[model samples]
Target: MNWTDSLEIAIALDEAHPDISPLTVGFVDLREMVMALAEFEDEAEKSGEKILEAIQMNWIEERE
Candidate 1:
């Protein structure tokens, strides 16, 4: 998924890191985790604070 697919990325992250809290993750680590996903296929340089925040928010929602 691309940088714009925040919800999808969040879902994948939630599944991949079931024990970790998205709220505690910093943008740097979060971006790394997202880039590591098997389904993720986007340029690392494309990610920014806003995209990361959206992914984090979606991940928080996914957990709830």
Candidate 2:
């Protein structure tokens, strides 16, 4: 998934880190976790604060 696929990334993150809260993860760690996903295939340099925020917001919604 690319940087634009925030919902998909959030879903993957939810599944991969069931015990972890997205609110607790900083952008740096979040980016690393996203890059580590088996399904993720995007350039690390493409991510920015807005994209990260979207992913985090989606992940929080997923948990709720």
Candidate 3:
């Protein structure tokens, strides 16, 4: 399943479990980790685009 589905299932499972906590299940931590990675990926892509654009603008021109 996708992220949303997995999230909903996690919630349901959490609601059902009295003995297990989020940390014990590793659900909360893992979700935060996945979200952080997604944000990092987005930032990295933006940085990469800026770097590429700068490189193109600063590239050497032909002497002809």
Candidate 4:
């Protein structure tokens, strides 16, 4: 799957398992949130690069 797909999966899972106050299930930590965002951004950047590469080649490819 692509980075977008991974991000979508993460969001969907989070939504479906929404955290409970007493549990960590749906808890959203500021730090973790930032980290996840940054990580996603970084991964997304890779996706862009991959897209560029494919474009330059006049083809399509998925991130490895």
Candidate 3, lDDT over the whole model: 0.33
Candidate 3 or 1, higher TM-score: 1
Error of 4 at 44 (Å): 24
Best by lDDT: 2
TM-score of each: 0.98, 0.98, 0.28, 0.24
Q: Which ten residues in a row have the lowest lDDT in candidate 3?
A: 55-64
Which of the two, 1 or 4, has more TM-score? 1
Candidate 1 regions exceeding 4 Å error are none
In candidate 4, which residue ranges exceed 4 Å CA deviation? 1-4, 20-64
Residues 1-64 of candidate 3 have per-residue lDDT tens digits of 2233333334433444435444333434444433343222222222333333332222211101
Which lDDT values do the candidates have, in the order given?
A: 0.97, 0.97, 0.33, 0.33
Q: How many residue pairs clash in each candidate?
A: 0, 0, 0, 1
lDDT tens digits by residue: candidate 1, 6-42: 9999999999999999989999999999999999999
- lDDT for position 16 in model 2: 100
Backbone collision tally, model 4: 1
lDDT of 2 at 9: 97
Candidate 4 to truth, TM: 0.24
Q: Which residue pairs does candidate 2 place in steric collision?
A: none
